[model samples]
Target: MRRLLRTTWANTVLLALVLSFVTTTAVFAKNLDVSLTELFPSDRQVKTTLVINKVLERFHYRRFQLTREFAAQTLDNYFEDLDINRLFFLERDVTRFISNAGQLHDQLQQGKVDIAFDIFRIYRMRVDSRIEYALALLDQPFNFSRDETYQFDRSKSAWPVNEQQLNDIWRKRVKNDFLTLRLAGKNDDEILKQLRKRYEGIMRRIHQFTVDDVYQTFVNAYIRTLEPHTAYMSPSTSENFDISMRLSLEGIGAVLGADNEYTVIQRTIPGGPARQSGQVRTGDSIVGVAQGLDGDMEDVVGWRLQDVVDKIRGPKGSVVRLQILPKAEGTASRRLREVTLVRKEIALEDQAAKSSIITIPTDAGAAQRIGVIEIPAFYRDFRAESEGNPDFRSTTRDVRQLVTQLKKQQVSGLVIDLRGNGGGSLTEATSLTGLFIRQGPVVQVKDAFGKIEVESDPDPDIIYDGPLAVIVDRNSASASEIFVGAIQDYGRGLIIGEPTFGKGTVQTLVDLNRYVPGDNTDLGRLRLTMAEFFRISGGSTQLKGVEPDIHFDLGIAGSDQGERSLENALPWSKISTASYTQHHSINNVQHLKARSAQRTAQESGFQMLMSRSRILSEIEAEDTVSLQEQIRRRESDQREQVLKEERHRFLRAQGIEPVDEDAESPDEEALEKQQKVIDKIQTRESAHILTDFIQMQWNTAYEQRTAK
Candidate 1:
């Protein structure tokens, strides 16, 4: 499928998801209800509010306890752990919490009561004290160890973990931070700090990071008013997420999640350090991890997942020892295994576009070669750009380069594959479709104010003016739909896959800058869906993805996995007219559709795949789990295998010899015959077979252009 990096969309799939649509020419303000100084509370209110916040937080978290006393006791115990003195007059507050816990729970659950202003008044006072304390530390140097234990330094005994050390870390972060700042064209340190502070503040407001149980309670209360996807992640939790997204390989070499103390393995990425070792298995828990083969093993019980991830990740060729706690007990004592793995890219193939060629015989004359280009996503080198490189990686440029390469081979027709592509940067998709169409409007977006704007093709030069086809399944969403819809509307390509994964809307990544103290930290992306794209034909591609001209029996239906399946997604519908010149070439669509239908029915592979898909679908829908159920599953799977075997046998039984799935792949004998056939109008079985080869469909496409 052709995946697009452009963050564009269509249809009502997304809007229907929210159960609301913006009125035409409407204007509204986002109610970000926040007091900038909430986190930086007044000193007097800090203590009172902090205690209330923590108490409420504990109640919200362990709500299953139901009883106020039990929940309060749990909260008290938790605070004692963050700091012994954290719970000053703990018993008094615990007693008070127990008395009001039921009332608070009932009121909040009913959405009729809130003690927030009163509770937060106290919380702010305590937050003020905490802020004052945290700010104090900012002036002091960071703590350090001058001893040999500090590893990086030993000759000087050890560096002091004083304010100097804190300054050093801050200074060290400057390199990456300043890189971003420079790109923003900001230089003054004071201004940068202000921006960073604003970003950090967003963490506390939208994402409440509190040890205070009561504060957590209010945050959850606030969040419940919105949809399920909106959330408030703690500061520490946010930090952990940032690390996970950036981590590569080394160490124990596994992605993990926690089910209590067990570090359960997620998927072991192929060709990654974990997969290469071949010793680890999914469902295996890493009970212990050590830096080296004989290094001291640390039992990673109840530790944060990121902390465990840290122990297991390192530079390539590093050795990490792990004790695998068997998924089943009594298998063996924790097995100690050491794996020295080199870090490699796990999603390397997914990072770039892939291509293929399909050949099909025509009814009256010869076969056609159809080139398929599958773009995964549009990606950019953000780091390179931040590093002052004007020219860096981008999807538009990448597709341009790939299309040029395919053209050199002289393909007859081309199919842009955009299935399962969830959309990315808007710039990429807009530029990408321009590679096919001459300069004109590609997508028309209508904002809430009924402000309509037509985004024109960024480039006017056509890359290849060949017979074009676009393949999109239900998974082809957002930008995928935009490009496909444009090409189809322009009569530039025939969309041949199932209806796209319709995602009609555009989302802007809202930077949490307003709440941060400094831009140096707490930066994050919030994707907010807005606007919708309408086709020139007066139809929206939102919920209703682009339908193919040649409707082949691909095992996909809208209700099954399309945008229609998504919760809070947009719906399918038509829109009003926008003037557009109808491309004259589209008049032949009916004939093209008919021609494709007859050709597909004659293909053995198509028949076999459809039958296999049906059987698999049936097997998947079963509810049985007994040994008898196993028998049925085996029978179902075997049927698919048998069908394949028989087809192979049928080919062998024919005069045609067995060959790899690549047709027109230059068998020495075929190559010699090709020259003779090319020299004269020679009628031979091999020539017909070669012309109709489905495996090397690209070759057939190439021949179509040359044969003409």
Candidate 2:
């Protein structure tokens, strides 16, 4: 609803019936093989199909089933779900839209070029029509004009609970969006007005795109049939994913969702106001907001979701309040809990590079250090690189510096952490792997055809020839897979962690502006999944992420952690082996694994995690939920309490004061315990295994080097 892709707001007036199916009179026969009445029983149905077809055709798509009956139902659903009845626009505007929508449907089915022009012309009319109205209210205080009071809950009260009242409810909604942007530092002065005018001018041309949206949507629908992830990126929405993954947006700490009024907290950023407060939940919905508590809470009904987000966002340290509506059942209304939050800068540290030290004891009671470097993503600021700056930020550059620092700490073994890294810059991923292995093809990319392009580490010298291991998780995707796979293919190091994040497709951002010439310069960008990355073994890293040699459970409470959890991801299948040669020795790795398996069986921490996983799975698999089931739930709570008590008893045995079990307030003691536990487990792993696996391998490699 809040079309943030910067397209002009058209208020979608003209798609009432699709004329693709004509009256059986045989007046039209240009690939029009069906009866309009059969496709659409009513004029409204016909218009909806027409709109659907126009948008579908743009993707140069093939195959679709839009029956007139389905079109009506779809429209009904869309309107109900979006609460279109609560629109703040004038009745005349809505009526015109309904009329135009029908005409457009006819033109679309007829395959008329005029249909394209109609899209532009009509969208221009709608945007131009509203510009003055929006301008009139731009400087005004937030006003709902309390025109009506209608209980909008249809299930509770059937029929129109005062249609005009519903309209008034939505009318107040759009104003809030304008205010949100202004609060986020956009002044409603003359300068911003000019900027908006320019941006909107460019946006309108993009919106009038008669062919592109339909084509892309069609492609997406088709792909959705196969799987969700394998689809065409509409040229207008390109680079959007890249922007999101990098954590570089300005404004509020919240992430945007499709629906205008609802939001899902992706990850609460650390050091931000939300994190500092620790009250705003990850899945909380921002039902309403106020500049402050005393400010009136406007009903954000029928508002574009992103517009609501814009309203809540502000400069760092600025106070804002969100009326949180958490997820709930239809029978139960989500509580409108008010939370006062402050705006602050947030960064994705979890996605950044990290390092760890695994202490392994040798036979002589001496401690050897194995430093682990975790590269979550291949990050680089190309904008910085192009400016002739040596300080151009990059993962490879950062890891190389980290290597120098790690060596200075006298570490004998190194673990490159690729677990949970979704990958970034192709260049950085390739170059980073070269730091470990002496150059070769890191990954082979194949396009639409069988043709493959092998991307190699364009370098031949190994950065660290010491005993090495690469720690990977199910989330190690794309370039992360390439790096880990290459290392394993050449037998350069040990691979640990679960299977990686199986995103192996290569996407190129296509700007719509390139196709549509002048006046549409700001047309959205598209990211087409153009190619798949293959390892030297000819097997594609599709649904399967890289598997670790020494696999360890992810220790997540109940969630799936790696390769198979993602939806619509490409399938994991292997092609015939490519002509390649193995280059390193894991002869000692098999031996270490035999020892590690035996040792891990005795570790209380490992056993605790495994047992906890079983209990967690049982909890997740339960489906019973009713008021009567509350007693059963209390029993389950008692079971959890028992587990907590046992854990506390164990902590007590270790001379650690177990955290309190009040469970209602913030768990400060629990957090402290968790940190300490993670520290104890990861730090003592080398000695716990009773074998200096990395060190033994390193010494073997060193002796091999010396023998040569």
Backbone clashes, candidate 1: 81
Model 1: worst 10 consecutive residues (lDDT sum): 17-26
- Where in model 2 is the C-alpha error above 4 Å? 1-223, 230-248, 251-313, 319-343, 346-356, 512-525, 554-568, 575-581, 588-590, 632-636, 639-691, 695-708
lDDT of 1 by residue, 1-708 (tens): 011113222112222211111111111222354553444323222333232333334322112223445334433332332222221122333345446656654544433223443444444444344434444444443222221111111111222244444334333232222232332234456434643453344234332322332343444333322212223333343443344334432233344655433466643433345544444555566756776556865656434354456566555554666656433221111122333344343443434676655554554456655565667654555557679997777777777777787777666666666654655555566778788877777777765345667767746688877666665555566667777788878877566657776666554323343434344543232333445677756688777777776555636334645566544355565666666554535444555455455654665545544564565455334322222223323443465355446445544434345433223222434333332222111111112222333323455568999999
For residues 1-708, write the lDDT of model 2, one tens digit per residue. 112110110100000000100001111111222221222123322333343343333431122344443333332322233232323233443344344544533443543223322323443344454444445544555533333222222321222344464443333433434333333334557324643453343334334333444344433433343333334444333433333334334334444343333444433433345544444544455556677547755444333443355456444556677665433211122124556665545444433566666667676677777776767567766567678898877788878888888898888778775644556566776788789877677777665455666667767777787777776655467678888888888888777656777766654434444553454334344333445678888888876667777767624431343346543456776666655567776776567777766766776665655555555454434432222223323444555555565566546656677654223344544544553453344334433332456556567779999999
Error (Å) of candidate 1 at residue 374 is 2.7
Residue 165 in model 2: shift from native, Å?
A: 31
Top lDDT prediction, candidate number: 2
